[model samples]
Target: MLNIGVIGAGRMGLNHSRNLRQLDTIKLAGVYDILPEKATAYANEFGAKIYQSPEELINAKDIGLIIITSPTYCHIEALRIALDAHKPIFCEKPLCRTQEELDELIPLITNYDNFFALGFVRRYSPNFAKMKEVVDSGELGKLLCGEIRCLHGRYVRMHGDWFADYDKCGGVMLDMLAHHVDLQNHLIGEAESIYAQSFMLNQNEDELPFDYVSATARFKNGFISNIQCSWLRNAPSDTEMTICGDKASITFSDSKGLLLTKGGKTEKIPVDEAALNIHKIQGGMYAEEMAYIVDAVINGKKPLAGAKEAIDAMTFCFGMMTSAETGELVKF
Candidate 1:
């Protein structure tokens, strides 16, 4: 078994632990969190040991891989430890909070060929994978332009909540929109230029903060995408992406299966709804993502969303944030 050590016993860490149990080849070896109760609870429930610190987990002889599901602020330190130990890593994304961290991180990992995967869960979702396959297979013909819309209900949190802090979570752009940004880059190409704007909609003393942003990006492959995302106080959560090509168009949603429009007709492309629903309820795309990483490490195959891809996706996101603040188009 490929024993995996997890840092952070929060929701994401819990999800990863559960999914790791479901895999026959992977074992949840140990867990660590700043909150002793949290780590103890997860270890007890999952039948794993509780580590005294992240250093212990990373250095554990049984752990062949380390999953960093810790908070954003702690990701860098955990990753540093894992890299230094030469352990394979699976880190939840927006890999690091700022470009300076990225600068320090990129050089550190470039010379090492250890297995490192980031959590861009959408890449593992079957529906989005199908969409990517169609777009890349040329079945949709030459890519023209695309649009992505992501929305979430304002989860109420206090001022001290890390999610509400722009510096910690990087607001919706880094926290939420990073998914679509990665998807956009995955489907089209690297962003060559970007223009973006945002409105900090609701800021109340009693309730959590919220933001809405819209960005336009031109890819080096000559495709353009208009992306919008929001953290709202009174709205249903939904996400949609439509990629238009010269011959046809492909659109998908979390609730709806893929839809292909061609020759004046549209049809739903079939997907395994029952299996997808089970994965969603269990760990959603995260479960699938973990499985893929496990398989990669076992078989010596490279992961699709490695450190470079993670950096590229975050680079695009930071560019958008810079554009939003400066009110100028930022270049990749």
Candidate 2:
């Protein structure tokens, strides 16, 4: 069995651990976390060892696979260890928390010789794939503009946790909006410039950071997208993206729906119908993403998305944050 060691025992790490445990071909070999108690709990529950450090986990002779599910800020160091270890590895998104970290990571990732994948699970959604197909096929004409809305239902839920700290999680921008930002950069085009505003950066010492952000981006291919994301105090969850072209437009949402409108008509494609049945064929996008990484690791194939794509997304995201900071258009 492929022995996999995971670094992190937080929310996302635990989520991935559950999924990893569900995979029959892999063994959940060990876990490492700064918090020994959390790591111990995971080790005890999952029948894995508590690796004292990332180096210990990565250096394990029997553990051939590494999965880095640590927080955004914690990713860089752990990833550097795994990348240099020459083991097939998977890392969760946003790449890193800051430009300094990005600068440190880029060369290593580019020069790395082994399998390296970044988790951008939205790519696995059939709706996303179909939308990409339609846009690439020119069925929507030349991609022109778009909007991405991600309302996270409510904001009061994570009051006293690490996620509430903007310095730690980057509020909603790095924590949540990165997914849609990557999607737009993927389906729309490479980001050329961005202007963004956020309530996150300015905070009193005693309070949590704000939970809203809006960013407008112009792509190299002349595609423009306005992205608004918020964790409203009390609102229903909603996330949708609409890309428009000269001839038509396409819209997709994970739980909402997939739609296409052209010449005053709208309907779901057969892919959407197939998407309705994806749960029967495989697990949801998360599981499918994990399975894809596992397959790539075992078979020596590249995942649907990898390091370069992640870096592109992270670069664009940083530009947005820069724009937010300066209150001016950031040219990339």
Query: Candidates' lDDT values, in order?
Result: 0.84, 0.81
Steric clash pairs (candidate 2)? none
For all predictions, the C-alpha RMSD in Å is 2.5, 2.1
User: How good is model 1 by TM-score?
Assistant: 0.92
**TM-score for candidate 2:** 0.93
TM-score of each: 0.92, 0.93
Q: Write the per-residue lDDT of candidate 1 for residues 248-331, one digit (tens) a residue.
A: 999987767799999999899886655444433356777777777888999998887887788888899889888887999999
**Scored by Cα lDDT, where does model 2 land?**
0.81
Error of 2 at 176 (Å): 1.4
Best by TM-score: 2
RMSD of 1: 2.5
